[model samples]
Target: MQADITVDTKGMACPMPIVKAKKALDNLEPGQIMEVVSTDKGSVNDFQAWVKQTNHELVHYVEENGVFTFYVKKQ
Candidate 1:
């Protein structure tokens, strides 16, 4: 349940969070976890859809206050 890499996109919206997550994920080896922190509510669906379209895995996600944290595992 630990991320190998973590990126904070707390102030970013939509594609920016995804963009940064993609870039950060690129640095990870297969099976590594990437944690993305964002404040954008829409990213809940964005990350879900993005993972489905790619070879990665959306391991888990959580919402704390107004912050959204996504745990994605690279494939």
Candidate 2:
């Protein structure tokens, strides 16, 4: 999906991806979307849980070749 902003946490480990995502998400409008690209395997769980605790929408996610791409919509 298209995003208003994109943040790549490609070699980052735990917390960093979420950290960047949170910072990036802050720049987005309430209904805008942010795309996050992560190479950290644990980010899948982290993103899912993080979105659950936040006022954002997990639009969707995809995984390929150990890369995890997540789309989140600000709410």
Candidate 1 weakest ten by summed lDDT: 42-51
Report the C-alpha lDDT of model 1 over 1-31, residue by residue, as the tens digit.
Answer: 6889999999898889999999999899998
Give me the displacement of residue 46 in model 1, in angstroms: 1.1
Going through the candidates in the order shown, the clash numbers are 0, 0
- Where is the poorest 10-residue window by lDDT in model 2? 41-50
User: What is the TM-score (0 to 1) of candidate 1?
Assistant: 0.93
Runs in model 1 with CA error above 4 Å? none
Model 2's C-alpha root-mean-square deviation from the true structure amounts to 0.7
